[model samples]
Target: MASLWSKISATLPLNEEQFPLQFSNKVESSVVERLRQSRQQLYSNTTSTSRMLNAQIILDISWEKLNTGTWRDVDKEWRRVYSYGCLFKAAALCRENPSEDELLQAVRTCDMGLLMGAAIMDNILQDIVRILQCEVRKSVKEEDEGEHMQVKRRKTASPHVPSIKDGLAVPRIKCPSLESFNTNYLLPLKPVILEGIIDHWPALNTHPWSIDYLRSVAGCRTVPVEVGSRYTDEDWSQTLLTVNEFIDRYILNKSQISPDGVNDVGYLAQHQLFDQIPELKEDIRIPDYCSLGEGDEDDITVNAWFGPTGTVSPLHQDPQQNFLAQVVGSKYIRLYSPEDTDKLYPHQSQLLHNTSQVEVENPDTEHFPEFIKAPYLECVLQPGDVLFIPVKHWHYVRSLEVSFSVSFWWS
Candidate 1:
């Protein structure tokens, strides 16, 4: 749940054998320029870093919301900035003198890591970029850093906590004193999963849209795949192509065939099951959504599955908050908190998780050194059990049995 890191994983050489990111040179070059400039201004303390954080984090960068199928196509963008190594030089700069501008600037340079880390940080401190933009950060002098914190508590001028009528709240708790909590708790952002939130969740499990899609994968309409994963050997191109054809045919195929073996498609397959549970009409958007898809803030898709073992294509903390709901079979999840960012060896600026899947039951930390001491939160999801994975959390899932789940997110 929390960790205070001494060593950062960015020191290691990146394993090129993992996944090739064919980034769009045109789309990413500007992002790199802004990141460079931000870093230049960091040591100078230009106009107060916190005051400039909003512009650096949200306005200066561009984020694209993509489906699982085509996400790899943008790999080149990641490589341009971090081609030589894990390239986390910025991490060191941040630890020495953490500033709002510096952090935002570093994330700008390492866009992929920023996006991946943003997913996790956003859950805990929702509208973080916005907050930084609105609030002015006056650097506290060496002897006064602690004093400012104390003054914040003692003054009548302190800001008040506002209430939300109907919205997800970020976990930014205010405490009376530092002594009241452990130091480790402060390093990592925390997520507050909303319990008993949606009313129709129960009805979805009993009558899932799994039957048709599971049978389709069973029939081999598309091959079983491990997309963009750092686990087993996988063919990214073929897998992506097959998935594209499946969607085009079933959804836009012009041929009205029964939706079969679709559970393998993941949560986005719910786009097809629109007819199964009419009550869910208000909860989701279908074919139309398939075009626009989920937002960049929270990228979500319904992935369908139906193998004896429901294997995930990859181990990643993509640019989204995942809300996975098992529909038919069961699944076992092994996860590491976002604070373990150093251990995962996450690809800087690339569209993939920092960790490689090595079956945690008996991990091979010799290969994944940081994994040895990484802390995690594991959960077993059954039909109807919705698991919320905050962004940047390293996770691996094994299909307990043939399984299918619907997942969607809006950040």
Candidate 2:
């Protein structure tokens, strides 16, 4: 236990000089004093649960202020407060001879801060969490080697292509030049299937993104998942689960049960997973075509979508240009031009204004009569295919098998 603590401690910043809480310039001196006092209380008695709880209360006060304004307008001091709280809790847990669950909780707390907090604070928690994850993966591998091998064998088998529904097929080009793509696709606002562009991605070759490899690296990390048939359903809700739990219940178990027997669906959709798990991010590369737009490379937003077959993303439109890259499995997609927006019948509510009321696959013709006449282009997105969708173009998607996709959105 002492050796374990030594390893954890070594990963953390050793002193205030290395990890200072210098928010006095950005916030009131009184607020800075409160943060300093709370940090001191944690270090004074690192194993005291009561002290940790008290520090959390102080941080929570700062956190509540963040919700009062738009995210970009919120004071940086508040984000730092939340980040510091996560770091304090992680350090306290490390001193108490923490269990595996405790370590995971600490890592998750830090990850939340990293995702939502300010960048001014030191990322001391990143190193601490990586060390913790490595230890957990070691134990998991020792116990589940046989199961892991079974999954690898199953995943390596060729994926079956399902029949795609009828619609005008989106045009496919074999890696068009930047000038050609901009002239024919980007400027014209036409959606096109790009081939030969993503074949060099490591995800398709040397370090393939297989089930076993994903479970090994991120099995213990916690992530948010959408539970229920699809987001359009009233029952649709979101919850957090470890990567292993999601794979076991949603991906692996689905294979064993009959399609009709399956009740609930879990989808890890539209998540910035790369920012949390840097290891998985290494497997992918952003398309060079993103540079054709006005936005800088840093302005691009990358999101991951992973789920089983039958998962649906109801007809919706996005505000930016999208490059949907399929890494594993396949999907059937339908696209309607912005000119058909009125026919598609968008929701009246401010929250769902971008989503159409009509189900693309099974339309309610009586209520949305115009939707029946809305012409659309469809395609079967296979492995290594990148579908370039113009801004505000209505699109509907459904997975044909257990799938993983990465989408890059830029202005």
Candidate 3:
């Protein structure tokens, strides 16, 4: 854990060791009690709806950001805001499939994101569902055998790689419900955009945010997010760096100004690098406080979200799977699968986390000629678009317009 934290801190410059967090016993106790009560109800009565309700409640309160900085005003105000919106504990209650002990372990060990824990639960539930399905199939086969009193074999078509349309085309209908979405569309590794889903948010209005604003939003405030909780080390000082300075700055310190608007928009530092974007130095509302953050590397790192014009992360991947989501703005994504190891010509040197050494924008075919023929996937991700980059997929993203999105991963 310490190595992970240090690596994260070294990769993205931030005060990792002293990450700030304060959890209230009142909040924690209430949440635990709620879960316990719901668990009891679930075990006692199959007809009870309490399990579902408890799951919903957990989803709603899981992502509340801890109060950053020492200001009581900021703390109280933000808590109220989060409380009002309700954190959708996406991980906690996706489904109830894990055994009681396993589920309890997940709850205790999950990071602030609760990604791994939730996934375990969901997977367990999925397993049960699969088991039931298999039982039904077996019964049907038995019935057929009894009726015919003879054995028979039938030919079946071989499955092929699926098309995005085959995966996500919604049937002509009233609207989409999660229950209706085919499991195939549940992207395992990709960026997703939930355009129409914004209506589900109770506190937020769905007006799209600009690319520049979204990337620079982090510079407006210097709030260090609570590490291992809701945010990582870089996520803590989210507003301090730009698309360009983010990775480079961590290589070493500089006399340069930090990303612009560091003094106000939730940032604690303001130095040379920040002078680039004049708007941050001038007056502007902190409409949004931070930029989109990277997800956990253990589950699905090696991921990115595109921002229009000004947002781009260094090409990189971790030792796990990844998914990208684009809620706003369009991003042009280029991909290379694990088999293209030779074409990518990964670096012979150390100090970088990327597997593809070739320039993503302009490949040197002279040195590495095979890149042209590498099997790749390309897409313009718009609102509601999600691009999955399986583990070891080399990708470069360029935002075509103002974009907002989220990335998902597990360790």
Candidate 4:
């Protein structure tokens, strides 16, 4: 048991030697009691609707940021969050015949540990599922077996490939006056794929950013890279690597395939690479549409997203309106309106608050049944294509090939 906890702790973004997995009863009894009462109110001979209301009540407790800069920080903040999850799980086990509250409290207190951030793993999510125990979640998967099978078969589709679509086309344009773009799309929060807008950018013609070009330009620069199948995966980890080294291992090396027969992807996603490597800024131009914002051009933040084929940015929303420009290769993008937040089952964690818990490509219906009702718009962004994504819109992205994309974010 000790070894297993050690291994799990090692995977998390924390120093296990300093923050070892340990439990305390005296510290967490009160918090555990509150969680137990909340759980009992939810499951106690109540109608499903009533249970849902109580669950929402529990979730609605105001979550204030905790100061995690000292050893006292973990005890003051992280321990309570960890205990909250455990007690909620133990309460589920007493559903048939309610057990003594004190006995359950003792067990939950002994089982607690610290997780500094708001993120929780699949193992913890399973415990949360037991706590909420929503009825609709059970039927979600069985109801969509055919769709799941389709996603499984499509997983191996060639890189640069677009996912199967329902034939709805995203409006595309060659060029548009600033006035026209603002009125037709920007003001309405609608997405469009702009073409001629990026043709003049030096990235497309003046300089081809091949692997060699990237190495010569910013080879030694260190940047954060995400390693795993996707950010939503439990095994995902972020590491800093030089641009040259990242390209060599994840891109140039052929033996770095996963046991599942897919490439183990490393994505340099949403990084301010242009700022880090200023010379690289000369390669691209921001569109005139961003000028509609109140601030000057400097207010617009530029992010570089580079990755191998099969890399995915899971369903998530950004704070600013985004213009994602495809510089090198293609990408498959899906967008959902903010109105579908309820259906998307957003993660109940502060750090991941902007991210949806459901997997867009192959969502687990039993766990996120509401997702079945969320309508979405999708497009395949080809080289030089710029996609306008409104602020707070849920979007998912998958690289179709060895792709390099630059996104401009503005108010």
The candidate maximizing TM-score is 2
**What's the number of clashes in each of the models?**
35, 0, 50, 4
Which runs in model 2 stand beyond 4 Å of their true positions?
A: 1-14, 24-34, 41-75, 149-167, 255-263
Q: How many backbone clashes does candidate 2 have?
A: 0
Instruction: Pull out the clashing pairs in model 2.
Output: none
RMSD of each: 24.3, 3.5, 24.3, 19.3
- Kindly report the root-mean-square deviation of model 4 from the true structure over all alpha carbons: 19.3
Which predicted model would earn the best lDDT? 2
Error of 4 at 177 (Å): 0.9
- Name the candidate, 3 or 4, with the larger lDDT value: 4
List candidate 3 segments past 4 Å from native: 1-219, 223-315
lDDT assessment of candidate 3:
0.37
Q: Model 3 over residues 1-411: C-alpha lDDT tens digits?
A: 113222222322143232222334544666655554544443343332455566556545543334344433344433432321121221222234433333322222222222111223222322322222233233344453353332112121221212333333321222235443323323334323333443332212332433223323322211122111111123433442333233223211221222321111121122221222222323221111011124322322222233223233334555544445455556666666666667667667574536565555567789878777776665556665445455666776554433445554433
Q: Rate the local accuracy (lDDT) of all candidates.
A: 0.39, 0.80, 0.37, 0.64
Error of 2 at 147 (Å): 3.6
- For model 1, the local distance difference test gives 0.39
State the displacement of the C-alpha of residue 308, model 2, in Å, after optimal TM-score superposition.
1.4
Sliding window of 10 residues with minimal summed lDDT for model 1 = 1-10
Rank the models by TM-score, top first.
2, 4, 1, 3
* Local lDDT at 360 for model 1: 61
